[model samples]
Target: MTEPPRTVQSYIDQTPAWPDGTPTDFIPMTAMQWRIWLLAPAGKFFEGLVVFMTGVALPLIVKDFGLSPAEKGIVSAAPLAGIMVGALALGGLADIYGRHRMFVIEMVVFALFLTGLTWSPTYLWLVVYLFGVGLALGCDYPTAHLVISESIASKDRGKLVLSAFAFQAIGALVRTVVGFLILANLPRSGRGAGYMPPRSCRPSCWSWAGSRSATAGIG
Candidate 1:
């Protein structure tokens, strides 16, 4: 009888050794793997949070900073620029050193820079700190994926990696809900009362949002 046509997957399955000649072994899921999977997604969550929170905080930032259209544009684009730099620079470093080391280091840097957003003294400072946060976030993208993929078994790898990335959507949803709630509680005039000055409402809201966003990654 003629043999059936071999598919790509069949070829892969039939192969008993890696290209380097190491024996292929099935890796079992373990508690450590589960932790890495969850932690990797948390990085994506923070990335989404930082990206969306800027939109939520923009109007307030503009109002408080009295930013001209040009300045506003720079503020909005700063994080993206930082991401580009980090991806090009730090991503390569992760490849050379190791994924897990970069993963932990990047998250710590991300948390510190992200939390600093709340205390920015000026528009320039805010832009600088936001850029720093984005740099750390950019580093996370590759490192997190690499760590998760390497830690998990081949059979379940695709599902787990995609599942981890799903947290980005969750982060966006959370930012939207939180932004809505904060706006809902504010006065119709957009000014806060009590201890906070009418003009201080925007910064206060931004601070609260920044703190919450930082928490997601830090934990």
Candidate 2:
């Protein structure tokens, strides 16, 4: 016998305690679903994190390094250009190589590039790192959604995919606030007004030069 469809009132009457929410309501997620949900958004989070952070940091980086217009343009475009290249050239490889392997590989590459970005010794290296970071993020963009969409219920796919993508906005907003706070409070000792590469990675020679420059400027 065919099942009867529910009335509008029946749908409205539902609540979470009604023996676990139905698909139309707060749909119950499986353990695998939960993991994919949490993990998928991470790609967008990093996309927003690095993209906004780089854009924000660019001014300070330029001021500190005294970049010309052409050099500045290249630095500005490197990551974005990488995103396009990666999506076109590398994203499709997930089909042949398998999504799981591609996902892990991309994230590993992202981490390495992110670490290198912090330790960038010169303009060329900085651009290279940024491009790599973007490339990794680009590769993850399609794979993450595919993983989530393929693994979840058809009813829940739209909600999960949208929520996962929203992380980019959240990441952008959070990083913007963080960048503002750091800029507002950082001690202005020479190059301190500019971006400070993390202490562990800061080059001693450059650090000394920045310090010396700051002292001279202060005087």
TM-scores of all candidate predictions against the true structure = 0.80, 0.74
Worst 10 residues of 1 by lDDT: 189-198
* C-alpha lDDT values of all predictions: 0.77, 0.71
Give the Å shift of residue 9 in candidate 2.
30
Model 2 weakest lDDT span, ten residues long: 209-218
Find the candidate with the highest lDDT and give its number: 1
Candidate 2 TM-score, true structure as reference: 0.74
At residue 193, give the lDDT of candidate 2. Answer: 53
Runs of candidate 2 exceeding 4 Å displacement: 1-27, 189-219
Model 1 C-alpha lDDT per residue in residues 31-79, reported as the tens digit of each score = 8878888787777787677888888878767866789999988888888
Compose the digit string of candidate 2's lDDT tens values, residues 9-38. 344344435545343455466687698788
